[model samples]
Target: MDDITIDRVLKSKDLLNLTDEELISLVEQYVPSQGCSGAAYGYLQIVSHICYFREHLQSKLMKIAIRPIIYLGINDHKEVLGFITGEYLIEKTYKPATEFGRDWIIGKLQLNETLLKDIFEEIVIEENIRF
Candidate 1:
């Protein structure tokens, strides 16, 4: 894979390892520059989607290994821009052969759900978090 792919893989792995508190600290550490905030928003958006989707589907969360949290940039009109792919992992042990739900998987990999929700709102508004 190329540098971008590798970057994503490492980022995902890095993200997956964070504790809920660490994840919040990670977000708090950044959020000033346009680029950083944009990427942060993108990450939260994907997580939110996964959570909402899993909730709506009532799907039992998964613990799949070697899963990739793939993303693509889309405009307000739903036009595709570019793709952002990352490797997401589950640190907790799981059953031998069952596929896990996105919520359960991403849940362990994230710091906190509330933080992600706020970040997502900022992204939706294209604004920085207040306080």
Candidate 2:
């Protein structure tokens, strides 16, 4: 493993030490629009809290128990960066991004019709590619 890549994993492992609420908040910041469900502003001032319950079995394990590795591979003239262990530790809302990406696209598409249509093109085509 490259020294730089090893360092990055160690840093992410640091994130695992944070409380679950803190970790979820970080993810929510990256993805508030999806959770808000198209409600950008006040939608009745009911007090709210976010809670996630891991399956009883998985909760006992420490997040760092997951593997720690990163990979560099090329695709479509780009270097693909992948972390082997971010899979288990990242929240399920991110399970899509962690493994297959359709869930990520689905979350975004639910927020934007235009984005949904673009992703739904009947065939694999050039020029539609995003940079």
Question: How do all models score by TM-score?
Answer: 0.24, 0.20
Candidate 1 regions with alpha-carbon error over 4 angstroms: 1-10, 32-131
lDDT tens readout by residue for model 2, 1-131: 21322123223344334455543344333322333311111110000111112222121221111101110111221111112113222423322222122232233322344422332231114324332
TM-score for model 1?
A: 0.24
Candidate 2 Cα outliers beyond 4 Å, as residue runs: 1-11, 32-96, 99-131
TM-score top scorer: 1
* lDDT, model 1: 0.30
Tell me the TM-score of model 2: 0.20
Worst 10 residues of 2 by lDDT: 42-51
Could you tell me how far off, in angstroms, the CA of residue 11 lies in candidate 2 after the best superposition?
8.1
What are the per-residue Cα lDDT tens digits for candidate 1 across 24-67?
Answer: 34333423224532443334333333333334321111111101
